[model samples]
Target: MILHTTEVTPLSGYRLLLRFNNGAAGEVDLSNELDGEVFEPLRDPVLFATASQHPVMRTAAWSNGADLAPEFLLDLMRVQQGDRAA
Candidate 1:
């Protein structure tokens, strides 16, 4: 999941538009999944947008003192697959 540009549009929930280096794109909805301090900063749209521009996006913040993980993306991907399945 090597991405080129990741544009995150925060809707009613947190939605991410991931554009991969290979031209593949996917979206991740992180509404119900995150409801803790790790997501608190993201409540601020500006901070969230800036974080999304980082190399690893939210994961980096989560890694450095923030309470979250890179696995969040995998979970989101699973949710995406589930949506496609249904």
Candidate 2:
């Protein structure tokens, strides 16, 4: 089954609350995830907190044009919850 993000809310300091369509939710700290050129703009607090879910994409994206893949987010959640992906 393909996973899609239902919603994303900015928490603090590169952390975000993510809700998935599969009823799984997690708080993800993106501090370590942010890297390279595409994520440079997100270093700004205001931009980091601008996480929004794209209706069409159904993924979280920021005003700086940075976005996180659903697969990556799901894996992170799985690890955080101490559950390995099957």
Candidate 3:
């Protein structure tokens, strides 16, 4: 099944609370993932708080055009939740 982000809420320390279309919801910390040119800008708390669910992509995105795939986010969420199989 293809996963798609249905909602996203930015939290402190570069974390995000996400809800997927499949009924899975959790918080994923992205503090360590902010690297490279595209993700660099999100290092700033202000910009990071701009995270929202993209209309078309159906994934987390920021005004700077930076976005993460839903599948990636779901995997990270699972890992953070201690689902080693993720």
Candidate 4:
């Protein structure tokens, strides 16, 4: 998923205000989700020290090294958003 943070605003607690390129803006509460390995590094103050240090873009490749369809990206985005795209 492409997480382009246009503006980041600190909430009352550990939540963050995220504005995506699709114009779907929402607050992702990460207070409890930060315990996982993928998000554990985000707790470090150094990662945020550099604005250029962002998550790497990983393209979805098929078994034959072929690029996945555009629908796949959309499906992934929906899954990440806690929705099952039918």
The candidate scoring highest on lDDT is 3
Look at candidate 4 and give me any clashing residue pairs.
none
lDDT of 3: 0.91
Query: Which pairs clash (backbone N, Cα, C closer than 3 Å) in model 1?
Result: none
Taking all chains together, the TM-score of candidate 2 against the true structure is 0.88
Which 10 consecutive residues of model 4 have the lowest summed lDDT? 48-57
Candidate 3: misplaced stretches above 4 Å? 84-86
Best prediction by TM-score: 3
User: Per-residue lDDT tens digits of candidate 3, residues 1-86?
Assistant: 77899899999999999999888898999998999999999999999999999998899999999999998998988988986322
Error of 4 at 17 (Å): 1.0
Deviating ranges (above 4 Å) for candidate 2: 84-86
Q: What is the per-residue lDDT of model 1 for residues 1-86, given as tens digits with 9 covering 90 to 100?
A: 54334333334456565543434346666555556766666665555544343455433242224433445554465578773411
Rank the candidate models, highest TM-score first. Answer: 3, 2, 1, 4
List the global CA lDDT of all models.
0.48, 0.83, 0.91, 0.40
Clash pairs (backbone) in predicted model 3: none
Candidate 2 per-residue lDDT over residues 1-86, each given as its tens digit: 78889889998878888888888887877888788999877878898888999787888898877788888898887886686333
Residue 10, candidate 1: Cα error in Å is 7.6
lDDT of 4 by residue, 1-86 (tens): 55343444445444444444445455544445445545555454444222221233232222222222323444443555776322
Kindly report the root-mean-square deviation of model 4 from the true structure over all alpha carbons. 9.9
